[model samples]
Target: MAAGGVSPGGPLGAYVPGTSLLHRCPPGPKLLGLLVALTLAIRWPEYVAVPAVALFALARVPPRMALAQLRPLWLFLAVAFGFQVLAAGLGTAIEVVGGILLAVALASLVTLTTRVSAMLDALVVAARPLRRLGIDPDRVALLFALAIRSIPLITEIVRNVREAQCARGAGNNPIALAIPTMIRTLRAADALGEALIARGIDD
Candidate 1:
């Protein structure tokens, strides 16, 4: 509904807002950190060696803000914890949860600090190094914007459709929900394509 906005799960997934030190880091390194954290997260022992002091540092971030960003993934984290505890034990469960959360915390820091426009600029700059692959910088930027913004927008549409369906007591039928959901999704896509063309995305 607004320009320079966010999407729910795609590129705009889990945007955290803040003006912390972590926010000003360059996009390349910030993205690199996410990659490293993800690798460490899959191994619980990695969580323990992360240095208590660093964990404490992350703790300094506003809990309410972090919690809000983490909310979307809470169910998945809980499920992973449950699985680890059942399949492994309390120790493993704690390890998995800590590792995953550590990654989340770092990512949250990046998002909270960086504005969407800044992120787009960074991505465009980073992709400049990829022009050797016949990629257009403008197109790449548009792609990033669309992918990221689509997340929040799609989530919004889905939420609206779901609520309307449930209000009519049709929430139980998967087919009913899927049909309308798909239709709405297609409509959104068409609208986006038209908007992009209008903005000269194809030319």
Candidate 2:
């Protein structure tokens, strides 16, 4: 997503330029730390707050940028939290929602501090062992790169669809939103597939 000078337009996988300790850290360690933190948070959701605060502080990312990472997910999180509250209780809902938020925040921190290329290189190296199982490390890394790139593309598509709907006073219509979003997403996928084929990546 950091390729060229184009911004991802959303905070999800966008790298923010900084010179903090986290930024100086290598992508492999950051990724390992993220996996560990997420595992711990999932196993003990009650303690998610501590790491959430610590990571954000350590990353030194702008407050607005950090918070923006959660903006798109808030609605989905809220709904899931409400379901948890009804199925279990307030404490359970808090733990569930807190863990989810912590996971997102931690992953965002890694991406924000580490460059996309660095992460892909680290992944390729880490996946080398999988070559024994007939898995191509470069292809695995390329797949990850495409997945990361798609997130922002999908986000932008949804945003544009929402804006257009709002302009037509159909902002509250889920059907209107879902239909166009799906259509656009499919078109984008087709274009991407064609591009890949043209580059001899059809296999």
Candidate 3:
């Protein structure tokens, strides 16, 4: 399989299971705070932002996971920032992208420290006011749960597909690789749905 490699599970899916203070904090505070922090990041342009972002990132995850979380986006951030600098000289671009990085890192921190179930519950509760309408909070929560769970799940599929191709001595053909992976992923999704049903999560 001499074609290309995939990235690690991005920070959202790179949650390290642990019992740090971050891990112990109620999911609600983290979720609510994330919403507020994101609002500030988007609403305010002139504030010195990097340190706020850095502090947020450092507070939620282990040092090692923090480093790993930055791995996937490093090159992309570099290229985007580099283009910005080239296009408009350095200063403003540096300031802007640094703030952007913090926003991303903040999101990663929330996803990293919080469990998937907790995230699902938060989404459901937030949308609960819509329960009077046609919205089904439980189903919506399940959808979110599936969405978050799918990140690592799909990452695993790609990993397994690469390993399979290596064993079969097949060269890296995107179509061939993708087809089998897609089939396997659909099967996994169906199985997951069935399991949820069995557990009454779909009820």
Candidate 4:
């Protein structure tokens, strides 16, 4: 997606415009809150995961939609938590997974409520002090925006690739799926690079 163009929301995990309190909240505060929530989740007691789950509730996104954002991670989470269980124990595993999920949910909430431009502006403002280090805040902010915006685009691409493969009865073939997905992803990246260069952002 271009910096100025408004892309449609993604399947399942895209932002839904709303007038709720979380939707009205400023991106800066929401970002700070996410950081704090993540920190607490990582370092605090198991009970802390409770309120972390509550944070998603405060975001007011539908339960099904929120689950959609998380469903993709289940396989990864399962493997990771399984390791924790073997190395530590069930209780420790639960705490770790719960904390991680809470953190992810909080981040998803921020993305859902905040606009891409608003997020970039917030990042630029936060990066102002880094000027002493010879960093370009605008460039850094643009990079951040591109990274966030690409998530939905990439998700959509994968969905399309999977559906295409399934329609051809090749869905079970990893090679078929991986090859096209990689080719498409690289093509998209090359086009994005060309667009950036054309706009005089070659650096």
RMSD of each: 5.0, 6.1, 6.9, 5.8
Identify the runs in model 2 with alpha carbons over 4 angstroms from their true place.
Answer: 1-13, 133-203
Runs of candidate 4 with Cα error greater than 4 angstroms are: 1-13, 83-88, 138-203
Residues 27-94, candidate 2: write the lDDT tens digits: 98777888888888788766767867887788889989888878999999999999999999999898
Q: Quantify all predictions' global Cα lDDT against the true fold.
A: 0.71, 0.84, 0.73, 0.79
Decide which is better by lDDT, 1 or 4: 4
Candidate 1 weakest lDDT stretch, 10 residues: 47-56
lDDT of 1 at 88: 97
How many clashes would you count in candidate 2?
A: 0
The residue pairs that clash in candidate 4, if any, are none
Question: What TM-score would each prediction reach against the true structure?
Answer: 0.60, 0.62, 0.60, 0.60
Ranking by lDDT: 2, 4, 3, 1
Please list all clashing residue pairs in model 1, or write none if there are none: 7-151, 7-152, 8-151, 8-152, 11-148, 12-148, 16-112, 17-112, 18-112
The TM-score, computed over Cα atoms with residue i paired to residue i, of candidate 4 is 0.60
- Residue 20, model 4: lDDT of 78
Pull out the clashing pairs in model 2.
Answer: none
Q: Write the per-residue lDDT of candidate 3 for residues 109-158, one digit (tens) a residue.
A: 87677776566676778888898898988778767656655766788898
